[model samples]
Target: MAETIQLVFYIILFNFLLLVVTDVSAGGKMTQPKCHRNSDCPRNLCWPPLVAICDLHKCFCRPQHVNLVVRD
Candidate 1:
């Protein structure tokens, strides 16, 4: 009975560690906001290297590259 309990505990721990590793490996992307317009997203909220863009009703920050590909 004690061995069975220990095995269950180890399984649970392994699952938890697996989830953490997956999250870390995925780079833990930042959460974006749902928006209908560009005005809904504010520039101040975006980080320095990233700019807020509203595309397909989602507002998220993307890397700034001379504003060539996408405009604000």
Candidate 2:
């Protein structure tokens, strides 16, 4: 019975998180402070391990700077 309750809780939590993620990325409202060039960013702010990168006419952290989550 406890396992069943746990599973139900997980499912509800998953659905809530899903809605949040969807809403954030839904209507182009997820413009979390993007950049276009190095000069556009603060000096030495995103240096070293997190080099600023320009892509699609925007600047951001290097892909390697972020951790990727993959599931089976």
Candidate 3:
């Protein structure tokens, strides 16, 4: 019974670690708002590297790291 409980605990721990690894590995993807101001963002502010941008219609984070370029 003790062995079974230990195995179950390890399994749960491994799953949690795997989830954290997967989340950390997936970078450069952020959720932004479709508006112009910091109030539009979920955190009530936009991150420094990503600011608000509105193209007269929809708004999203303006990339601050790289230049405005469209990729294939």
Candidate 4:
């Protein structure tokens, strides 16, 4: 039926929109460390809305601003 087809189409569209939003937000990697509290980040580091994993040892403010130094 036309209604069934329309519903399926809307579902597909919604899924596609979700995928796009996720991709734009996360760029596909999910292992990145997100700050849950102030202790998660060092004093000198500026906490952005989101953080990404730089390597096995550290999570950075972004993919580009790696090797950040934290002041005591």
Instruction: Quantify all predictions' global Cα lDDT against the true fold.
Output: 0.60, 0.48, 0.48, 0.49
What is the alpha-carbon lDDT for the whole of candidate 3?
0.48
Quote the positional error of residue 10 for candidate 2 in Å: 0.1
Order of all candidates by lDDT, from best down to worst? 1, 4, 3, 2
Predicted candidate 3: what Cα RMSD to the true structure?
A: 11.1
- How do the residues 1-72 of candidate 4 rate in per-residue lDDT, one tens digit apiece? 999999999999997875555345554533345554424644434234444434444444443344354321
Please, what are the lDDT tens digits per residue for candidate 3 over residues 1-72? 999999999999997875554334323233334655434444423455454444433334554453343221
Candidate 2, after superposition: displacement of residue 40 in Å? 33
- Scored against the true structure, residue 63 in model 3 reaches a CA lDDT of 44
Model 1, span 1-72: residue lDDT tens: 999999999999997875554344324444356776656766664655656666777665555563333424
Give me the runs in candidate 4 sitting further than 4 Å from their true place.
28-72
lDDT of 1: 0.60
**Candidate 1 positional error at 67, Å:** 5.9
* Model 4 per-residue lDDT at 56: 42
- Tell me the TM-score of each prediction against the true structure: 0.41, 0.37, 0.38, 0.40
**Evaluation by TM-score, superior candidate among 1 and 2:** 1
Candidate number with the higher TM-score (1 or 4): 1
Q: Which candidate is the best by lDDT?
A: 1
